[model samples]
Target: MNHTRDKESILQLYNKVLPKLAERIYQNLTEVTPLFDDFRLEKIVDTWTKDRNASTDKEISIENGNVQQLGLKLSLIGFQAAGAQTFDLSKDLLFSLDYSYYEVGPDKNSRWMEKPYFEEWTSKELDDIAVKWSEEVIDEITQKLQGL
Candidate 1:
């Protein structure tokens, strides 16, 4: 009978709950994901070095979500060898999580259910995300190598 009152109640509910929902989403995205870990960077570096005749003792240090090459160099046929180059490979590794709110119109009101549902991501999906991030790191390394 009172449409304005119903909309006010919905807005009030969204205002009360959205911040916590956003925080939980951010924590779940960043804390559990291995995207910024050293192991991930090592995997990327390993993949890159696997094709090249690079040394086995490639060292990497990730501090505060920043990937720092301890002492790595590339000596390709055309490019001269640059000794002990430290690359800030974290540029591509930087990530942020975002969430948005949408108001359903009368025509689209039936599209979603009354309750919101969240499904835990499968291992395969997580692996796929990791692969994407690995590619980003590889691209950054390749660009740095080209500049040398």
Candidate 2:
């Protein structure tokens, strides 16, 4: 089997399909921006890019004309703070508005205070968009491979 053709196909798939997937994800994120309180999440969504972090390199490879080990890393700032809120009581102290005792702050009193905006967006919304886009790309590549 001539692996060169397979390699070429994989490269084509990466070049053509990956950006579309990224764009779709970006669009989905943009649509859900109103659900988040933090402006940083909106900033990250607006700046989403398919640079080095979103490429398939050595860690990902093409095998027998089939795209294998393909992966994408969506690099964003403050991604760690996206899920749940964690405070270190040993190193940090929680003070109330009057600075008397430990009490829930004003921000925590909000309905959306339980989970970070980015966390909800990534886990629920982004996951669905990514899966749908991935399946579309895979199906397209499969069709192309069949032709080859």
Candidate 3:
């Protein structure tokens, strides 16, 4: 296998491969994100009146993606005690994960750029999902590039 030739092929693969992979990852993440039904809704609102439902939703997206990099954003609204009333930890939260990829021999590799900015503010399930996403990116990319 010629090194330069392999490089060119990998470059070509990026345009064809990354966008599809990104879409799948985005969908996988959004499907499992929480709606905050488990949160303490009773304490947050004036429960003395009627049923105060603590509604929440996630704003998830594949922010950017190309040959060398991919970025993802996850924002939670109405998931906390404050229920979007303020920007503090007791309210809403947001974070981003970035992955960079490269070719090594006939395989591709990916890694997250850094720990999420609001990692400590998030739940264990969310942390696990983020880790899974990073691992899935490298595994899937490697499988796709194995033939090249």
Best lDDT among the predictions, by candidate number: 2
Model 1, 1-148: lDDT tens digits are: 2122122333332343333333333343353233322322111111221213234444321211112111112111222234624434332221111012222111222211122212233455435444544444456556876776
Error of 1 at 110 (Å): 29
Pairs in clash, predicted candidate 3 = none
* Candidate 3 per-residue lDDT over residues 1-148, each given as its tens digit: 2122123333333333333333444455453234333322110111122112313232221221112222232333333323232221121111111232232111123332234222222344444444565455445434534533
Each prediction's TM-score versus the true structure: 0.30, 0.30, 0.26
Poorest lDDT segment (10 consecutive residues) of candidate 3 = 39-48
- Local distance difference test, per candidate? 0.30, 0.31, 0.30
Indicate the residue-level lDDT of 49 in model 3: 25
Q: Cα lDDT for residue 65, model 2?
A: 32
Question: What would you estimate as the lDDT of candidate 3?
Answer: 0.30
Give the deviation of candidate 3 from the true structure as CA RMSD. Answer: 20.8
Query: After superposing candidate 2, which stretches have Cα over 4 Å from the reference?
Result: 1-5, 31-67, 79-148
RMSD of each: 20.6, 22.8, 20.8
Query: How close to the true structure is residue 116 of candidate 2, measured as C-alpha lDDT?
Result: 18
Looking at candidate 2, what is the lDDT of residue 62? 40
